[model samples]
Target: MIRFVPADVGTIGQKRKQVSRACNGCRAKKKRCRHVEASPKDLDSQIQAAQLAKGDDRIDAINDDYATSPTADSSTIPASTRPSLQVSPSENTRNPVCQSTMAAPPQDTLAPRFVDGLNPEGVFLAVHSPQDTRGAFSHDRVGIWLADKLNSKEKQNDRTLTRSWPQSSLLAGRHSLLPPHESIRNLTSIYFKRFHPILPIINESAFRSLGPTDPAYILLQQGICLVASMIPSSKGHLFLGDSEVPLQHREFGKRVVSAMRISTEAGVITDKIVLIQALVLMWMFSDGPDARDVSSLLCARVVQHIQSLGFHVYRKSPDQASHYESTMLCCVWAIDRLNATFHGRPVLMHERDFGIDLAVYIDSQMPCTRLFLHVISWLDKVIDMYRPNAELRSSDLEIPFDSFEDLLVQSQSLRIPTPLLGQFIILISLPRAVFSLSRIWLIFSPKATIETLYHAVSILSCRPRSFNTKILSSASRSRRELSAERVTSLVLDKQVCQLTYFPFVPYAVSLSLSVAYSEMRHTKVPMLRARARDKLQINCGLLERLGEIFYLAGLMSDMGKSTLDEYDRIYLTAVEDYQQNYSGSCAALDSIRATERVEIIDNSNAVPSTSREFESNNGVNGHSLLTQESDPSFYVDLPDLDVFGLFDPNFNLDGIDAYLEGNLNLTYPTNF
Candidate 1:
């Protein structure tokens, strides 16, 4: 696969000039030759010859001996500098002898077109360094300079803004700017506006209640600063070296816990505003290490305080009229993370005796079945995300416990009203238990039983390592095939389903599986056997498709900024994975079998025929998950021009998709 070489403006300009000097035949062949120039009617061949005495360096660079047709000598030099010329001007001129060459005038055919300048029109050049070297400057400084430049440019041609709308969109509105302090504040407001649902929940009153110096107040203040720093207009990193931000948040949490320590130490805080903010942060950082830890701690502290207060699960205080049960569900997610990190041992929310209260609280929320469904579904996702691969063989999951089962049973008795939710919990828990139980079976049973158990568990889990074409192929033949129309219908229905109304877990699970599975299917192209694998390959076109989905979802959602952020994270991870894991050696490409092209049975199902065959051919018969096949087809077949579309993960999806599908086309280049 070809690496994307970043071209400098000078290199591109040079290439352009060389291209102009070459005749079509020579240019296509990359050969040096004189192009035919227009013969001015007034000037005879003799006069033209006389003008040649001045000796054009471009002409000198052209080898007349081999200037005919497609063949030409490439050795040439600029006369003044005595430097080897990359291309000669003679190659750029029009052909006089060819009848068709005289048709288009040079000015009309090759005039340079400019849209927006790097620093905008009429801005003092001193404010910005050279384009390539200016990345180090802060956004605030850049913004100020741009604003000044735009002010002047607008007077010349009011339509000539400093930044092109397309270019601004590419940055997702985060311009390389340096705004003044006031502008920075305004920018913060713009960012907050994107996540407005968090506003009523985290109002000034909440901060005021926490006291001016409280850690919760401090955390809110720091959040404000972080928001301030990210002002798209400027780069003022809201934290003014106040190391107290984290301390304040931690301290505030500690204070809450201390105040409620005697009553109920395991209950979750029911405050709607706090829960929204925490959930936002959690969703925004599904993959981040720091954010994950911080969110878990925050949720855990809240749960601790709630449990300490001895508040009835159904009980409401003047200050706790908000939905505490839903909030506890969010805390459950945090607890899930903590458990994953601690090797699957979840912390006890409270003593086993007090578990009844929490369970009762959960039971009281039965009328809000839909809400709990969403909450548990979201928890299901978080729980599955950090699922452990424990080495120990045990009858039960290696969930370390100080009497957690007793608590689970207590909660179980509290009456989860929804059958779908009950089924969902069973679905989530069964696989883990079965997988763990398989190991235990191996410990106590015969080798034959162990193998049976292993196969059963693997089949049920649908784990990547357990993938067997024999199994899926068999399943495919026996099971009713999901038709193309059905696939399309399902996709459309998914689009119509209001994500806000769905439980968070389904969204997380569906999103991760949908995105990752699509990527796996598309990118896992077979080596050399393009045609053979085409029909049979699983070319889900995941990178492109999922990228499109994320981009569009980001645009439509209220948390557009955070969605954009997640898209970037996913893109980077995908790119890194491609670069590190799938990149193959030149030898591998050369070794591809000639018959490989026909292996693809269908374009949609295309896997790397040769690459996968290579693995099987090598006798790699372990679980498919452990297979080491590198699917380089994505890197190879993907169009170079639109490869970086996800850089602006928040791009308009319908437009982009239409353009990609050849239904619509963009006239100008922007992503590159």
Candidate 2:
């Protein structure tokens, strides 16, 4: 030191030792060691800073350099070689401070530190910041260097965790079950083109924006695929190509189950539009063994959900809703109302609850949609009016009849595009048939008494009578009065029949034929009577043809046969009674004539006196001498002529109220 030796003038080994002994912070800055002479306070602060910079290479080097530093106070050396130091409390202690001036030790010398105050128990501890406990990487420049290695370890741990806890249920594992994008697109196209016109529950633009991975979209797609696969090949050709594949029943069922589970688990039923769309599609496409019953149960579930969600009471304000949403609400309500009617169940909502006006909807350019909504609304009105306690009068029927005729006229006037022709026919004709049936129901309700029956018969028989003016004035004017002749003619008209081909036609035709036959049996006019019989035969032939077209009609055909057989039994009884009365009268007249001839021959001389005696022997009036030619009660005494058995003791025509109050069994079709 007195000679002032250069600090860099050490041997090769000595230089390497000096470099190794340097604190990492000084080495990193390429400066001489300064922390070696740092006071305890400075050292503690440096230690904390190092811990905060957990993965810094400088922290390890600082720990190593402190362990090998020769002197606790390097201030004696030249200021150029050693940085300045601050004094700490440890300098005042009497204990000898530990010092290290030796050359760097071998690799074995590197170990965790056990410093006083930092590790009082003499156990080695690695100092690190709280952030370091989470990971050994950082976003700083130095951290970028460590991220690659740390990220690799993290990925491995994630893989291990996934393997340890695997998803077990289909819903929990639906991500892998999503169909290919191409398949989804194809099915969606088929659905939009074929089913949407009929249902129109989904908004195409909004649905497309949700993308394929959305859970609700997945459910809708699965339903669509199921529906598409079930469509007959002939119908499929209208939407999809021959090369397009179809899903198997098992696959379709699994998808449906998975979609339902996902929706339930995710609690998406709260989303009214999605839930309604899915439910409506499911209701429409449901088919298999017992499909109608299953679908009906499903419809009930939908109604319950709708009520729970307050959809039945939801009103659309023009400023608050999009056109699509309003249209969808209308469509869903229509579907629900129509399905309830078809199943003979109570409607979940009433027409008055709806804020959307049918009159407004009817004026919209979408004729098919307007017609569909109009028909369902009319049906709802029919249900309300037909209830047991409803204050229904003949005037109440006028609105429905007027609305029905208006809808039919509007439907006929519209030049429907060719693509919608099939749906247009179904939508238009189904309501037309139901309207015809409702008219029949109104005329023959359980309230109908003997006089009403006679009046109805007279109208159905198309006989001109004074009663016609009284009855026809109250009932609304239709395209034609609801009569047996009109119904039969409608069923037999080649064009109209072809347009309205469905199971309902056969049902209406059968009921009308029964009514005609009942009225015919009591008709005194031979010409009208024969005409009724011919019309009955013609309608029966039409029913046979309808049965061939619709399998459900076969069941209705059996019901028609039972009705006709009952009519025949009553007619034969009445005819036999009339013939017996005629024979007895003829025999009485012959006896009277024989007695008269005998009296005339025996009293030939007193012929004038005998004639006077015969005239006087008769009652006060000559009319009393003849047998009464007419029996007013002849037809009235015949069996209660319920040709359709609608008013039979086994059935209840008490109306919709009875039906809603758990007497639904009475509403089931006899053949069903």
Give the TM-score comparing model 2 with the true structure, all chains together: 0.41
- Please identify model 2 stretches exceeding 4 Å from their true place: 1-195, 206-272, 282-296, 307-315, 351-365, 391-400, 403-405, 408-552, 561-672
Ten-residue segment with the worst summed lDDT in candidate 1? 663-672
* lDDT (10s digit) by residue, model 1, range 1-672: 886534221121144532234578987898775443333431233233333333334442432322331212111211232112122234223222222222332221111111123544213322332442233234422221111222233345633332333233323211222233454455446434332221122354455478543333433433443333322222322222222232222232233222222112122323444544443333222222243354445556545555555432435532354554444443343344333322223444433434233433344442223233233333333333223432132222222221222333433422333321123333345577675555321111111111221221122222222122212333322211222212223333422221111112112222322322223233334232232123112222221232222222222122223333444454445656554553443235434542354454433456656877787676443323323343444333322222234445455544432222210001111110
Q: Each candidate's TM vs. the true structure?
A: 0.27, 0.41
Q: Give the Å shift of residue 221 in candidate 2.
A: 5.2
Taking the tens digit of each residue's C-alpha lDDT, what string does model 2 give over 148-209? Answer: 23334555786765543433333445544545556656656655655565446777777778
lDDT measured at residue 581 in model 1 versus the true structure, 0 to 100:
53
What's the lDDT for candidate 2? 0.45
Q: Candidate 2, which ten residues in sequence have the lowest lDDT sum?
A: 441-450
Could you give the C-alpha RMSD of every candidate to the true structure, in order shown? Answer: 30.5, 24.2
lDDT of prediction 1: 0.31
